[model samples]
Target: MRNLFFILFILIFVSCKEDVLPKPKAYLSLKYPAKSYKKLHFERPYVFDVEKNATVKDSKNNWLTIKYPNLKATIDITYRPIKNNLKELLIESEKLVFKHTVKAEQIVSNDFINESEKVFGSIYEITGNAASQIQFHATDSTEHFIKGALYFYTQPNYDSILPAVDFVKKDIVRIMETLRWKD
Candidate 1:
């Protein structure tokens, strides 16, 4: 009689408990450093401002690499002298950017022209699983031509790397905006 009474009491209390509720969505809390830039003092055909946190590597043929060690990403830059091949350079740049169409959802092209600086270019912002999230080309239309692309070390995961993309994007834009062709 005592054992039966104890089992009945336990069952009643267990069945009276509240149901578990689902939790709300949560995201990572990432803190980035403040933005600062310094003029690239390297002896090159062109000059631009780079982020203070980045490391610049000089490569053959006036090519440059701006590495963000903290973000594990690099902005590759290729500089070419425009003789009569401006057409070819522009075509090649567009072709390289469009190659990502197989994976990109959409590509946003923004045209920029600075008359005083004689800098004209187009910036392509790609959204999706594309290998390169950003690609751009700038030129003086007479002497200097520059192309750049942004790449992460890790595999493409747009959602996860979106924040880092935005962070480095500012630096890239800074490069474009401050770019000046050297005579």
Candidate 2:
């Protein structure tokens, strides 16, 4: 009877231990964390700076900033047609990542023009364990570009901090989807 009690207690304790750990949240939909982001109107009308810090310049000379506090993130949007310096612009963007990240894991590049009569751009996303996505959008011969990156600390042994990374990535996606170059 004592052995049976001990076994039952051990089973209960092990089962209870699993409940302490939280489940990882999957990236679903475009909505970002509200508390950590802010919206600021820019000169380009519908195109706004959804960021904080408001200082770091990206590959295309657009100022980057944090949209909300506690979210260590940035969005750098530069609007110009790709007539000249297209090659130079791409090179500069490449440097921005290679200088910091060890390597690029996954990259998805695409050209798009939204319905808002705004921009057409080649979006580049460089993903790693701690990845950054650089989206370059251009319209006409000139390069109307919005290049942004999201970064977070890589996970340690038993714990993963990539949740924060995933959260910020959602914010980047939200900004990209809503981007519009106004008249």
Candidate 3:
């Protein structure tokens, strides 16, 4: 009976032992495919390079959506004729960007100027949980004005989507760099 009690006590003591060490931090590692771009030529008055993996959907009034189905994101592109409403158009575009300021940590503007291509615009990179991660407007300052915004279909979790956002930002920059207004 004494041996049985000793064995039971030993077992209980061993089972009660606890390791109080803190757990190592864990993070999600996401991998995406190497990016390849193809020139997009539509009947519209503009052309740009887009990721080959994205699908382009045409909407009314020369507006289009570049869908990244795998990433659950889309880039909405709208084309407008300057038509002497340049001020109004500029104000509207800026207003659209500022709307996200409430949720945005910071908004960085990068001027895009290609004298040879006659492309002049600004690209706004918004960091934080904003609805739109990137917004851009490219125009020839005369006839054609095109605006684009990048948005994810999912809730805006900036940390969770950082990788995807960075990937798409590069594509957006490429588009802005290669944009050409049709003569």
lDDT against true structure, model 1 = 0.95
Better of 1 and 2 by TM-score: 1
lDDT of model 3, residue 72: 98
What is the lDDT for 143 in model 3? 97
The TM-score obtained by model 3 is 0.92
Between candidates 2 and 3, the one scoring higher on lDDT is 3
Model 1 TM-score (2 dp): 0.93
Scored by CA lDDT, what does every candidate get? 0.95, 0.52, 0.93
Superposed by TM-score, candidate 2 places the C-alpha of residue 76 at a distance from the truth, in angstroms, of 4.4
Clashing pairs in 1: none
Give the range where candidate 2 is weakest over 10 consecutive residues by summed lDDT.
152-161
Error of 1 at 111 (Å): 0.5
TM-score of each: 0.93, 0.51, 0.92
Task: List the candidates ranked by lDDT, beginning with the highest.
Answer: 1, 3, 2
The residue ranges of model 3 lying beyond 4 angstroms of the native Cα positions read 1-5, 12-20
Query: Which regions of candidate 1 deviate over 4 angstroms?
Result: 1-17
